[model samples]
Target: TVFLTTHFMDEAQALADRLAIIADGMIVATGSADELIGAGSTNTRIRFRLPETSQLPDTFEARRDISAWELETDTPTRTLHELTEWALGTETELLDLEVTRRSLEDVYLQLTAEAAEP
Candidate 1:
């Protein structure tokens, strides 16, 4: 039963049960954090370190880091399952496995940016 407005995205994400993004005096988007981020544009990144000789399937658009490889995908659940299965099958040790999801701020920026576009 409380209404609050702030330019700080983290504050809104932390305190609000529901969120609405206003751009050009119009409500461009509205939803919970997960809903807005999961809609269509957001991507989850999977990062891991593996033996240099071991390679992932061609479907993964992997980029090599100093010691880790990373890829962004919309279907993280399926990707993780396939990755683990591949690791098990190849006897490859996955190191520093991390999943990074799009944040509320990212969604906010995207929504606002789209609204600004002609």
Candidate 2:
């Protein structure tokens, strides 16, 4: 059995067959990367940008700049489908779109944050 400790979640995910998260001098959680990430409500994250001329829908939580917008969603597949349809309907260009799963680091942070709460 190898006992290792580090603050780097990415390193833990990469090196460990089983991962443990310690917080406040206690073992808060333990699992593999997939297990930990799957336990969360948000399994997927979608990020995207639309053209400056495009109008953002009220359902989307987005941050806008001069020429682009960024947004994240928990349901990537459904959201992507809806977004694509919306883009087609609105005649907007979808730019800089990225879809990713919730990382081990995100799970670690969420667990630690919850542990810190009273």
Candidate 3:
């Protein structure tokens, strides 16, 4: 077993198989990167732009901005598949599609912030 301490989150995520966050001289959180990120209420977000005239399927719950729509779901694979199928069926185009997940840095910051809170 190897123990390493560093302020670089990317390095820790890359090299460590398991990680424990120490805050206030105490162990605040411990887990694999995926486990730590998933433990928080962090959902994968799918953001895209569709034609103003087009409407998304009812199965997908999305919020719309001026020209874009965003969907947050834990099941990104199935949600993406369903979205693509629906788009293909209706010949609608999804523009500027992006999928985002909670990163190790995000989880680390959240944990440290919580630890600092009174």
TM-score per model over all chains:
0.65, 0.83, 0.62
Q: Judging by TM-score against the true structure, name the best candidate.
A: 2
Expressed as tens digits, the lDDT of each residue in 16-114 for candidate 1 is 998889999999988887788788463798899988788877777688878888877888999889889889998999988999997888788888899
Q: Which is the winner by TM-score between candidate 2 and candidate 3?
A: 2
Give the distance in Å from residue 3's predicted Cα in candidate 3 to where it truly belongs: 5.5
TM-score of 3: 0.62
Question: What would the per-residue lDDT of candidate 2 be over residues 1-118, giving only the tens digit for each residue?
Answer: 9998888888888889998888888889888888888888778776667665668888877667665565556677777898889899988888887778888988888899999999
lDDT of 3 by residue, 9-113 (tens): 899989999999988999988999888889886558899998888888667879888878988888999999999999999999999999998778878888899
The root-mean-square deviation over C-alpha atoms between each candidate and the true structure, in angstroms, is: 3.3, 2.4, 3.6
Candidate 3 deviation (Cα RMSD): 3.6
Candidate numbers sorted by TM-score from highest down:
2, 1, 3
Query: Against the hidden true structure, what lDDT does model 1 obtain?
Result: 0.86
After superposition, the stretches of candidate 3 with alpha carbons farther than 4 Å from their true spots are 1-7, 22-27, 53-59, 63-68, 109-118
Evaluation by lDDT, superior candidate among 2 and 3: 3
Question: Which run of 10 residues does model 1 get worst, by summed lDDT?
Answer: 33-42
- Candidates 1 and 2 compared: the better one by lDDT is 1
Model 3, residue 76: what's the lDDT? 90
